[model samples]
Target: MEALLKAVVAGAALHSPLATLVQNDGTEVVLEPPANKGWVLYTVQSGDTLIGIAGRYRVDPKAIMYSSGLEGIKLKPGQQLRIPLTAGRSDREPRVPPGVEPYTVRSRDTLKGIAARFGVSELELITANPWIPSLDRLTEGAVLHIPTGQKGLLVRLSKGQTLLDLSGRFGVSLLKLAKVNGIDNPAEVAEGDLILIPGILARTTYDNLLAKREAERQARLEAERKAREEAARLAEQRRREEAARREAEAKRQARLAAQRQAQAQTQARRQAAQPATVRRSNFVSEGGYTYPVKSYVITTYFGRRGAYQRYHTGVDFAAPHGTPIYAARSGQVQVAGWSTWGYGYHVVIDHGGGVDTLYGHMSRFVVSAGEWVERGQLIGYVGSTGWSTGPHLHFEVRVGGSPRNPLAYLP
Candidate 1:
């Protein structure tokens, strides 16, 4: 019965897809145990990493990771993991579609460098394997798909830079960069986002970025130079306009001086042409007024004059001390007193019709108040008294107490 049982077990092994042998003692020996029937369902326990759980099942970490589309070793407690039927059976490759190559990430290898080495675009690699969360998580010992058909390199975007800027720097077109990154609006790309540069070297990209910065710097300097030149031009224009204004003012003053001299000469001629034999009026008349002093030398004229601070308001006759001052017309003496405001000993005479005459800077009065005097009569003497700067007769002709130009009434 033992021999028969041994022969029966060996015959079963021939069809069992397993090896069975009978030793000399007629004991049945199985060469390899059969693989686990179907898949093994494992409940995640505390302190379990993906690698640890895969080790317990004698499977690759990714084998468990790919089942749930997991990226890293993060595994939750109480989670169920489905172990493949052929997980530990000589560790085989996963199923991949046609025209794709399998690659294992190694130490110090970057996703950009790997894509460049294999002449594959970083976007194509990511699309082939959609399990990776980001390019930053492409750690060592991770498996990836490399697309050998299309060739390009991968790179991450930097700060303060745009896709157009990179296109100029890396000698790439904007449309090409946008198409590879699947960007609809180039300005909407986020910083640190991954992109692909087709058929370019790493060293060449670095050199291009440097050259672009230098070109921008030169453009800024040129703009500043033009601004300074424009400011200088405006300043020169203002200076020319100011110079022209000053020259015009000087010419106007010259013309006024000439006109004043001509007026003075014409007045002197008319005064010298007067009839010297005409008899003086005994009573005040509307016209025919005479000079208060015999001398025609005038120290100051009526109206505004350069020597006085304000309008002179009267004429001034310079004479020696005690020179007799006569009245210009017949009138009654209204005042005879000393004044402090440059009008020494002054006298006022009212000649009816709102007309009056004032004699200032006098030495002494010969006529008293309310006394009637005729034209050319002795009224006072010229001397430096009160606020006088010199011995002169300050004569004024007034209408209603306000001074008028004495020359308008003088012969």
Candidate 2:
């Protein structure tokens, strides 16, 4: 019965599709009794790396890694690992064996056409290389492997590098490298090309190129760091300059505001101490008035104005400092001095038939009280004083002690 069972197992193994991959001749193996099928644990010896152990037992290093649960921990002298009894190493990733040719895709090459040209079955070529991302699209300049071929080291050519340069550097024959990579002309090799080289020197060249790439990456990282620091420094400098400019502007504004407050206070005091100017009569007159200042822009109209919404009883003209102000109509000068009612250095004229005209915020008044001034005569100069913002004239036309729109009467 035992002999019959052994013969039956051997017959089943021979019929397996993978039987062709294994040789019939091999040494016999012994293991724990067939009833006990499980992993065996073994202590890690000194200088025993995971890969070395895996190769000795024909097991995959990655499989041992999973069984041992050593995801991040380092192996040491006393670490134990689980070794599987079954053949797990047979699942090793397939590699393109030596002597397999590599083909660079041409513009009009198809997978079926290339297989026929190389006299290899499409399945054989595709099975040998699992790295092909797509079988349908054969992009130009892309490197592919053919089943029946001669082997070499694969290297991607950098800019300005030629196959002749590789032949000289690796000491291999130029014709041999070209034949392995399916290149008709050795001189036609371009930059950014993936090609194969023919000797032991090919491995050395690949290693050197890898080291150079690492060095270049380090240099780029350092340059980027410096650029970021420079940008931050410049940004900080601009922020400081802008802050300083804003501070200076604020200080200037504060000084101007303080000056206005002081002037308002002085006028309020003088106004309180003096008696109010009484109207000459209650008679209301309709008299035509002239422009107070030539070449002036009407800044403030007679109405409610400004943030405080004060009732502006007069019209304001914007002009340069010391611009002459003229009398609106012929009348007796009612008052020509600092006003008791916030009008600094002002002039009031009583045009009979009960109409009166007043000019406020003057630098100086040329006419005195009771002086007869003609219409269009220069009575004063424009000034920024007593409730004034800048160099401008404040003109008013009063009828029976009430003010009217100056624009309505001027023209």
Q: What is the TM-score of each predicted model, taking all chains together?
A: 0.35, 0.31
In angstroms, the error of model 1 at 310 is: 14
How many steric overlaps does candidate 2 have?
Answer: 3
Candidate 2: misplaced stretches above 4 Å? 1-286
Tens digits of per-residue lDDT for model 2, 29-54: 33222322245576987656676566
Cα error, residue 254 of model 2, in Å, equals 14
Model 1 lDDT per residue over 1-411, tens place:
576565655443322234676777888787664443444566777656665456444567787777656776777899887665462332222222234565666668876788789876555555554445555445554556675643445555566668888898878899987876567788776544545666554444444434655777788899898999999999999989999998998998888777766665565455445534222223333575787877535656677544314677898777778888888988989988877677878888888999999999888989889999988999989888876667888889999889998777876
- Clash pairs for candidate 1: none
Model 2, residue 149: displacement in angstroms? 99
Clash-forming residue pairs, model 2: 99-149, 99-150, 99-151
Taking the candidates one at a time, how many backbone clashes does each contain?
A: 0, 3
- Quick one: RMSD of model 1? 20.5
